[model samples]
Target chain A: MSTVKQAGGRPRESRVDHALAEAVRALLSEHGYASLTVDAVAARAGVSKAAIYRRYATKEEMTFAVLVHDLREEPPADTGSLRGDLTALAARIGDQIGRSAADVMTGLLADVRADAALGARFAATYLAVERSVIATLLDRAVTRGELPERPDSPVVHALLLGPLFTWPIVLGEDPDRIPKLAPVVARIVADALIAGALPPAAQDGLSGGS
Target chain B: MSTVKQAGGRPRESRVDHALAEAVRALLSEHGYASLTVDAVAARAGVSKAAIYRRYATKEEMTFAVLVHDLREEPPADTGSLRGDLTALAARIGDQIGRSAADVMTGLLADVRADAALGARFAATYLAVERSVIATLLDRAVTRGELPERPDSPVVHALLLGPLFTWPIVLGEDPDRIPKLAPVVARIVADALIAGALPPAAQDGLSGGS
Candidate 1:
């Protein structure tokens, strides 16, 4: 998406991009992901099929972009403490859960299981934002002497988000339960960090050979 | 499925069930979940299609049963200490992961997102077994003065099995990494327990009203 046009003296591309994104959300809200189509998006946005194709090659990519577009704007507020940052970020994640997005995530995660390319895109597009934010917070925590060092990222991700993601799905809670449960999970994570329960330096080549 | 037959003079149903389970595993490995069919399973097992139909109502149900069939035989070992028990349980979860099962779980979980019936069955059939074992461990830990009280179960489940499930998928690690990474996660959960990082009661109606 580009800058504001006319009053701000920006390009026409801005309006088209906004319409495209708005269309995606409206259609997603109206009909679930399964029924969403590029033609419908083009018709709804009044943006040409050619323009939509120019931006995203497939319906899936278009949907992914729109779904996570909010991450570009809103980040957890800098609350000036490690616990506050962690809790804020966790709460940010919790707030993201709504009926429609949750439905979409379930289907998306299933596809991600076997598709490495899509998984990488998801990492780069969606997860990387959180990763960068979390890294900033953790590094700041180290600077402030809250932690001796940043704990491992995988475990950090797990503690920060694992419960929020798995709680309702695995435990039979209402899908809406994510918003309520997030704070409790965040507290558990903050406590884990305080107790030195996190390991330093996340490893990719996990485990020693037996 | 019934008891062992012939040699022990138990019911004949046991052999049919055994053959059916074996066939399911073999087919799942051979063709993957998408291609796995009741017709193929019956043929492979030399069990009649009628027998298979009598047992499972659909392809999804049959697959779910075969995939989780191992849980019926193996509960996580009781290692006599809270940390040990948590680690042991986590390790058991890790060991269950494999290529075929992971593929199937991805598909199944996608369906579980929208279908409450499947979700409840999953909790009762699979998660409930782990739940029972974990509850026993937490209660014993209380008796031994290891915890103030049993920690909130949703958070406990997240710490125990979250990273193992999410690490490979979310972080782009090999699906095979689960077996190795499981121990490390187990250690984290145990340390969280020692540090009192877990909460005492998991609420379904979570969060203070905003």
Candidate 2:
């Protein structure tokens, strides 16, 4: 709230942002979201609480910013085919979202259901980004007539992420193994869409034959 | 442990089991998995701490027993086709795994990554059951020639569960809405497999075509 603008705002603000990001990542990895407090973050970053509060109103907002920022992949370059686009996008997500980011999210997911405010933030940040990535790919496919209609965005997004996201946990494999499977997972999900695997309602009356 | 059997063997065991179940459900529902304590459970259930220790070796064992016990659905009646069998099984699971089960597991999941013992327990119980159900259905399909081969059980299980399990959380829909989608979800997953959506690795070299 006070004046720190004497040194020129942009560079100083970036410096604080960098410090806060480092602190949030360290604290979240070490103690997880349950113990992340504004005070701890402030102390860890060596910044006054005012700086944190100025940037984020709550711990959820702070954690969300750092974790989700890592996932803010630029729109994948168009690859002229639905399968290619999905493969590129899924690979980018798999490559960018590291083990710590996944851990932070898994931790945050537990808290989301209990707190409506946190759930709202998660949907707006994480879910919104996933939907945008999905839209970019699906819109291109629809334009190319690869799909009769776009499937439900949420369902389609889950198809892309659910199996690949849980691959390590479910199989007890190393998380590092996911990179090899990224394109394969993308291919399967894309082929599923091409094969008419949308649930009946998701088909949205597109195919009434059933 | 000392002399509870004075009343009778079977009835006393049942009573203790019932009380422990109730206590676990209440504690998990109220405080999630992170805060569950043997002391709290024993106090709440009015059983000795030794009584709990006699039953389960650790908190993970206790939580896994109570939570996974709820999911011990009887093997679904064989419905005579892959789709029918999957639908029946999925519907049963949807009906049994209520919001609280989902919530408790979601909370436990964050910790599972951080704790290897808990991860082992989760896989032995929750994932084991899921694999068994998928195996039952897929084995039947393979026997009946509905499938060229059995797909990878873990990947197939994820296809069945990953979307439906996250439906409420991702859509922000009421958990009560899952039952309606259960059959539909089953159909889609079954169709996906039939249509050869398995990633090339999961296809197990059944099809030589690229």
Worst 10 residues of 2 chain A by lDDT: A1-10
How would you encode candidate 2's per-residue C-alpha lDDT over B73-167 as one tens digit per residue?
34577888889998987776555444555456566666776567767766776567677877878889888988888876766665666556666
* Root-mean-square deviation of every model: 4.6, 6.1
Residue lDDT tens for model 1, A1-210: 532112242467768878988898898778776677899999999989988887775676677656643235345666778788888887766665434455576665666655657767666656776777777878878898888887765557755766666665445555565765666667666666766765566433442123
Task: Please tell me the TM-score of chain B in candidate 1 relative to the true structure's chain B.
Answer: 0.80
Q: Which pairs of residues clash in candidate 2, taking residues 3 or more apart in a chain or in different chains?
A: none
Q: Which clashing pairs does model 1 show? A: none
TM-score of each: 0.81, 0.78
Once model 2 is optimally superposed onto the true structure by TM-score, how far is the C-alpha of residue A145 displaced, in angstroms?
2.0
Tens digit of per-residue lDDT, candidate 1, span B1-210: 432122342457778878988898888778766677889999999988988887665566677666643235444566788878777777666665444455576676666655667766666656776676777878878888888787766557766766676665445545675666666667667666767654566433442122
In candidate 1 the C-alpha lDDT for residue A54 amounts to: 71
Q: Is the docking of candidate 1 incorrect, acceptable, medium or high quality?
A: acceptable
